[model samples]
Target: MRGSRITRLFRTRPMTHETPYEADTSRRRPTVLKALVFIVLMGLVIAGLLAAATLLRSEEGPKIAIAEPEPLAVSVIPVEYLTELDIDELFTGIAEARRTSRLGFQTGGRIERIDVRVGDRVKAGQTIARLDTRGLGAQLASSQAVVEEARSAHQLALDTADRQRQLQAQGHISQQRVDEVVSQAATAMARVDAAKAQADTIRVQIDLASITAPYDGMIVSRFADEGAIAGPGQAILELVEGGALEARIGVSARVVSELVPGDIYTLEAETGPVDAPLRSVTGVVDPSQRTVAAIFDIPETTGVPAGSIVRLKMERKLEEKGFWVPLKALASANRGMWTVYAVVGEGEDESWRAQPRLVEMVYPAGERAFVRGPLEAGDRIIVDGLQRVTPGARVVPREVQRAEAASGG
Candidate 1:
């Protein structure tokens, strides 16, 4: 029993080394748990860092695209209707005298006296110039002397012929002698007739040596001086008749077709406005100018000097066919051509876009142009703000009133 008790006590008693071993085991377990917790926390932190880096890289790359921009807003007008208009066509013309003449001497001679200078008024039968007639007068006097001598000889011949006939009747002279006297008398008579004719011719020439005005006129130019020698039929002076004035103008064939013989028109002269009546229209066209001559008779009281340039205003209704558009709608292009932006798209879902249409401006009346182009009726054309849009660019068109478009507002 004693041995059993001793062994049980020794076995139940706590050893010093045993207690320290239990404490060491307990400390080791706590350290292992702390290391495991640190490892798990580090793993979690590294995983979170990797996820954040991946997210930042994805954000730095290019993004997905968005929708396109909206279209621009613009005002548009439809193609206008054709109308007949009385358009005034202006032409430049020169004022002229109704009667113009270039006067010259009939015979060649040295000039002696010029009575009238340039711009001198002259009347009918007034002597304007004269040639030296000293030699002509001497010749005329000599011719008259010869005529007088011939007349005396003719009287003697007549007396002799009568005496010869009487002698033949009295039988005192032979028949042959009477015949000889008659022949002599006939020769003398013939000489007298020739002398008289020559004297008359010289007298007529002396009258022609003085240059006289054939009608009332004003001298415009002088070609021969007082001492200059002039040939026969050479121009000596240029004269223009007063009291009636005329205007000569060159116009197109189309204008000539609209004119009449007595149609009245207005002329803007340097002095003032005057009424000019159409006198004549030439049937032939001038080849160089491709125009026809139109003559108009104006009153002399207008005081418009000859060769004064004046403007002729004429208005006529024409059957023209074209569309009128605002000047802002036109875009300058190459070779004097013009472009207009038109809205081409249709329906609500379709987006309206700019489309270029070529046009030619025929006539410009006021702020609008009469244009002809490849455009259909009712086609919408952008008028306001063409610079803000381009061809093929989407545009929102706002319709404009026809009256507003016509008024160019």
Candidate 2:
């Protein structure tokens, strides 16, 4: 009875299924939660410290500083004023005589003698060449004999007419016979006149055999030699008249209108410059060249020879109070608008400032340019460093002097 009671008691003991380990884990659950919370708070604190350190490092980075530019060094020139400026038109031409002639023979014959050679100077009416007078002399002699016979016959006719008149007046002969004698005398007089006229024609032919210079000139060429046959209209010699020389040049229509007679021009020869004048202007336009012929009378110069190649600079008009500067000084900002920079003054700190000024081009005077602008006498211009300069840009001005004086400026 004691063993059964012990077994029943053990089986029916209420079945309480709880261990010591389980009770210990259930008791530490709140502590584990507290530990995880502490770990999360520590991580947030560490992240905040790292972000603050990064911000401090960024604030200490490198800094940038912009540098100032240096002042540019440049050269300048001053504008000038003039009383008269020449609008020169330059053209190339050849020197020619005022008059030229080609001497030829009127009568065809063999050349007998040559009196002048190439480069030989002669006066007007000077015999340059002579044709063979073999036939011409004989013809002249025959004509002369005929003239003399005609002269004698004319005197005889006059005497006969007077005699016949006297006989008719005295009635010594019949009226019919007197009339016949008078008619014969009149016919004889007419024949004498005809013969004299023929003789004069022959004399002219004889004179034509000798080729003579029509004016004072120098023989440039001899076309016929001794014993050469010269025909009528055949050129025997070429002559250029000596006195004043002239240059025949072509000018554009625009230039021609500006030119006037008696205007002075300068001709550049091999020796030097020769002063000349505008002699005449041709109204006819050359269809091929589109230009007019302008004749300039050049004074005779011993140093300059005829047929020389020369450069002619003609002054079409004069521009009073004009300024000139170098070609490099010209600058263009907008289309068809030009300007130039002028050096105004040096600052207290030794820096130069340039002022941009607009200009109008009058004309080109040789290598320089004649201009009209808001520039006064003795104004400095920036010639060398124009591109690097602005209106108010600081510059270091350096004076540039020209080698020669500007012409027509």
lDDT of 1 by residue, 319-366 (tens): 776688999999998888899998888578767889999998877877
Candidate 2: residue pairs that collide:
77-381
Which runs in model 1 stand beyond 4 Å of their true positions?
1-82, 174-176, 251-258, 310-312, 321-357, 364-369, 374-409
Residue 140, model 1: lDDT of 85
Error of 2 at 231 (Å): 0.8
Cα error, residue 198 of model 2, in Å, equals 1.6
Clash pairs, candidate 1, are: none
Q: Give the C-alpha miss distance for residue 79 in model 2, angstroms.
A: 23
- The lDDT of model 2 is 0.80
Compute the lDDT of residue 356 as modeled in candidate 1.
Answer: 95
> Which residue window of length 10 is worst by lDDT in model 1?
396-405
